[model samples]
Target: MTVNSANARIFGSDADAIYLAPIGTPLPTGIDSVLDPAFEDVGWLHSDGITEAFTGSKTEIRGHQGARVVRTRIETPGTTIGFHALESKAQTKGLRYDEKEVTVANGVRRTRRGAGQKVSARSVVVDVFDADDITVKERHVIERFEIVPDGDRVFTNSDIAGFPFLGEIIGDYITFESSGLATDTVWNVSVTGTPTGGTYALSVNDFSTAPLVYNAAASAVAAALNALAGVTGLSGITATGTSPTVITFPSAVTLAANGSALTGGTDPDAVASTTP
Candidate 1:
């Protein structure tokens, strides 16, 4: 199947779409003749965020597409944590699983420039017990989790030990992918804290338009996140640069539990203006 490089457009009827196509419709890859054995792993070849570059001019060389990178974000204050892939339950909060675990070997380099002809190799290992199940359900996760606070840099897709929401994004992963994908991605944020009475809004001017709401102190955090979904451009996002978007849950209660602070705002609450 062919895909567009910039717009990330998908062409050709894929297996996923062929069944939906007319019965006699022809598939580019002749996938229908193969019958069963539907390929153990199914990937839509969306913009895996992988890129294919063209050295030659646009006219002479073939076209390029089917490229994409995983977009990630964190709602917390520091860059310590980031896009991470968890295997089991140890790392995940809401989801139930055993624990997540991984291992790697490290070494120190002693380059010739460092007063030595050859570099020395030192060994170091890092492990996190986020998920480890010897007995129960065995699965693979493809979500993003980054402990940026630590020394780790970019998290690769191969490191995906297991799937998050069956590889669907949620939590911090949700905000990472949900952001509109033009200039930057959109991240509908969500925050939780003991309810308090004063009204609050997102801390930074991360979004193109600041959408802030404040009534009681409590309901502020969640409202700001929800406003991003329909927000038009990538310029309007929830998290500001290095700092995080903050929302103080409303402390006041309505008829029953604490009331929602995410109410009443202009049609578009200019980015950092409201709370959620």
Candidate 2:
């Protein structure tokens, strides 16, 4: 392969997030800004981030002709995810010890470990964000897994308390669903009459574009809208065409009363699935 600098990319792990749901829950078919209510965000994790491990045993077959290995077979395939939680909430404690929290008082909660307690399995979803663009990300789904404590638990005032956890893969190990930038919301702008120079505003957030001439160029209008200040969640907005200039937004937005609303915008679809 030839070396290509354009294809090389570096990533950072700061914006990654993890979510947990009941085992056998249905996976989402499309990517959205917010996840379903069934999945609970795992909150802050250790700075070391999440780690994945694969383990298996292999057997080799030898041929009698030349005393050489001919074939090999893999047995006992396994996969696991390791991570440390920085929060000591009830949900985190429950996952670490396969126990539920029992309320003792208004602000007091406790968890007890008993003999022959079976570990609980959960569906895990890990969302990894792109360093360059946080909107683009990859969602890793594990159908069923058990969370086991990876190290001894020590509570002390001298150091920060961290809970180490290991997720054991049970069945249908992992699936990756990737998404690109969100669809852009569009609108067609039409100017009528002999109106003087003025600014155009969006009805949704009251975001107004810079001053524009009576019949300004589409590119100029796009540049003015893109330069709007104090607006949130309206990135990569653009404008095209001459008379009925079309404006596109990075995400959904409401058009002002003077323009025609742009349509045909949809969120990115999940690229992979493990189950129906």
lDDT by residue (tens digit), candidate 1, 177-264: 1111233223333323433232334432222213333332223334344353322111222233211243322121111112244334
Candidate 2 residue-wise lDDT, 115-215, digit = tens: 43346678888867666655555667778878877876678997558888888888774454333436666676666443444433333345455445546
For candidate 1, what's the RMSD?
22.8
Give each model's whole-structure lDDT: 0.25, 0.63
Candidate 2 stretches with Cα past 4 Å from truth are 4-12, 98-101, 115-118, 133-136, 156-159, 173-234, 241-276
TM-score of each: 0.15, 0.63
lDDT agreement of model 1 with the native? 0.25
The prediction achieving the highest lDDT against the true structure is: 2
For residue 87, model 1's alpha carbon misses the true position, in angstroms, by 42
48 in model 1: Cα distance from truth in Å? 13
Clashing pairs in 2: 186-262
Please tell me which predicted candidate would have the highest TM-score against the true structure: 2
Error of 2 at 86 (Å): 1.3
